[model samples]
Target: MESFTESLNRLKEVHENEVRGLQNKLLELDSERCRDAQRVEELCTKNHQLREQQKALKENVRVLENRLRAGLCDRCMVTQELARKKQQEFENSLLQSLQHVFILTNELNRLQGENEKLKEEVKRLQGPRLKPQCREGASDPPSPLLLPSPGARKAIKEKTLEGQEEAQDDHPEKSTGHRTSPVAKISPSANLPETRAPDVSPQRISNQLHGTIAVVRPGSQACSPDQGPPNGTP
Candidate 1:
């Protein structure tokens, strides 16, 4: 009975040691769980702070964008107003220039009409005396020998000399060539008075009257037969 009591006491001591070791392990696990809970709470707080900062940054950016758009619109309106003012000034200047040109054109037309009237008045003043002279010239007989140009007179003289030479050649005994040349020379000298006379003809008188009619204004009177001659003519 004493040995059995001693064995029961040893078993009781081993069981008590195992119970103490299990109690210590349970205490260590409870301390580790408390530290993990504190770390999880700190992470949640930091995430909430970061989300609040992002919201503030987005609101500030939107305000700045709105201000920038308003500034650009104001500048555009100012530039368009300036362009419209310049266009108005250019149109006003063009209108003034056109008005000045129109006034100058009217002045030029008035001066041209006055100049034409002055020319016609001058022609009328010189027309009356010219008509009487032309009428007197038209009454004279026409003569081919009374040519106005020196070249025509010279050519006619040459033809007359050639005819005289031919006649002298046909009648050689009637006159010597040397004597006939002196007669031809004397004949020109005798006709010098007639050559010096005025070259008056109906054609020349008609041409002068036509020129006077063309120069005289339509308002002037026509020439009359009863009109007196000029002081220079008979």
Candidate 2:
């Protein structure tokens, strides 16, 4: 009986040691489960962050595309505007050039006509003088007198008329034009030539050609063969 009891005690000690080992293993397993749960929660949070980042990147890409499109449109508009402005400027310059050419052509034509008329007048005046010069090649040079200007020519004409008047005064029978008062020489057609009829008669017209004025008095007596001058006998 004593040997059996001792064997029972030894069996009891072995069972107790096995139970303690099972309890320690259960605790380690529970700690490992808690750590795994935390790791899973961290993984979930990282996934949510990645999803948000992807959404933001997509929005940025969309914004960039829209900006690029707007910039391209602006560039096209600028180019078109520049082209239009250049075309307008070119047309304006061309128009101005044409106008200038037209004006120059008109002026050139007018100058050419004047030059031709002057050339004809010079030829007419020089024709008689040139013939004599051609006949005598060894003749002495003429004096270097200036061609008469308009004012000088008018003075020369007045002197000629005065000389002719003096010569006519030497012969009373051939006297034509009579000198008149300055008041009588006033022109009636000073401002209204178109409204008045010509006060012309055959004798008055003939007298005008001789630088004379003829006046007709009202109720003048007709001259006959029996008439005599007031200062001379008939």
Candidate 3:
């Protein structure tokens, strides 16, 4: 009976130790589960934050895209309007140029006609005239002396006066039929359509509107000393 009691006490001690170890393992497992739960909660919080950030980012991207599209559309409209205005201006300029060219061409044709008429008149006047005796010797009966019509005489006198005036205006000196000064010749380039003088370069077009004339200011030097001799020199 004493041996059996001792063996029972030993068995009790082993069973108690096994129970304590199991309890400790259970506690450890509980702690590990708590840690895992905390980690999961942290991951969930991070995911929520990330989702919020993504939502904000998407909203910002949408806003930026809208603004960009609006800006692009506005810019396109501005560009189109500018192009339209430029095209209108160009067309208006072209129209004005055509009108100017037409006027110049008409003037040129009229002048050319006048020049041809003057040349024919000059050729007729230069030809030899028949003497009175030579007309008498002709076998054909003499025609009546046909005096120039009053209107014809008046027209001739007017033309002569106009020519004299023009000559005087051109040469300010005793009229020699020969041209003393160089004739003002228009260059072929001058016949081109004229445009509004570029605002930045007015001098390039100055010669087109006004013939070449030497402009001198009050204190400026003259082109030739001969034209502006010493104060008392003849």
Candidate 4:
């Protein structure tokens, strides 16, 4: 009986030591699990911050795109308006030029009609006429001077003087008299005289020519040729 009691006490001690070692291993495993959970939480917080930064960057990019689109639209509108204004200005200039051309055409036609009438009058005046009266022989009446009418004679004399003045104006060295009057510089268009024949003698023709010249040249103090001959003349 004594031997059996001693064997039972040794078996209880071995079972108690095995239970204490298993309890120590379970406590170490629980501590390692707590450390792994803390590391996972820190990683999640970093991921959330990265996502917020990405969203903000996307918003900024959208705002820049909108501003660029609006600017492009404004620029296109300005360019179109400038083009329209330029087109309008060009049309106005073309209209004014056309009006000017029309006015010039009318003036040219009126001048052409006047020139034709003057040519017809000149042809009529140049026709043949009766011979002059001579005193049996006075060198055939000095060849029957082809005298023009009073008005026509004045016009011819004026035209001749104008041509002389133009010649002098062209060559300053040939001009010996004073400057011509502004009226004397009238264009040939302004000098077109009325067509009419008048009874005129040679002396009368000379006088009328002299009068027309006096209109062009002012302050004439010279004596007329009909006033009197030189003292020695008969």
- Rank by TM-score (best first): 1, 3, 2, 4
**Model 3 TM-score on a 0 to 1 scale:** 0.30
lDDT digits (tens) for residues 1-234 of candidate 2: 898989998888898888889988888888988999998999999989999999999998887788787775557779989999999999999999999999999999999999999999999999999888876754655333334334434443453464456545643333244343221233331111111112223332223322211112122222321223334422
The residue-by-residue lDDT of candidate 3 on 1-234, one tens digit each, is 999999999999999999999999999999999999999999999999999999999998888789787776557779989999999999999999999999999999999999999999987876545565456556555344334345433433453454445555754333324331111222322122322222212222223222212221222232321132235332
Q: In model 2, how many backbone clashes occur?
A: 0
TM-score of each: 0.32, 0.29, 0.30, 0.27
Off by over 4 Å in 4: 1-72, 128-234
How well does candidate 2 score on lDDT at residue 25?
89
Q: Which window of ten consecutive residues has the lowest lDDT sum in model 4?
A: 192-201
Against the reference, the lDDT scores of all candidates come to: 0.54, 0.56, 0.56, 0.55
Instruction: Please state the error at residue 213 of candidate 1 in Å.
Output: 29
Q: Ten residues in a row with the worst lDDT in model 1?
A: 191-200
User: Which of 1 and 3 is ahead in lDDT?
Assistant: 3
The residue ranges of model 3 lying beyond 4 angstroms of the native Cα positions read 72-234
lDDT of 1 by residue, 1-234 (tens): 889988998888888888888888888777777777777788788778888888888997787688687675556778989999999999999999999999999999999999999999888887997899778767755323322234434534554465456555653333212222221244443221111102123322233232223223233333321222333232
Query: lDDT score, residue 234, model 1?
Result: 25
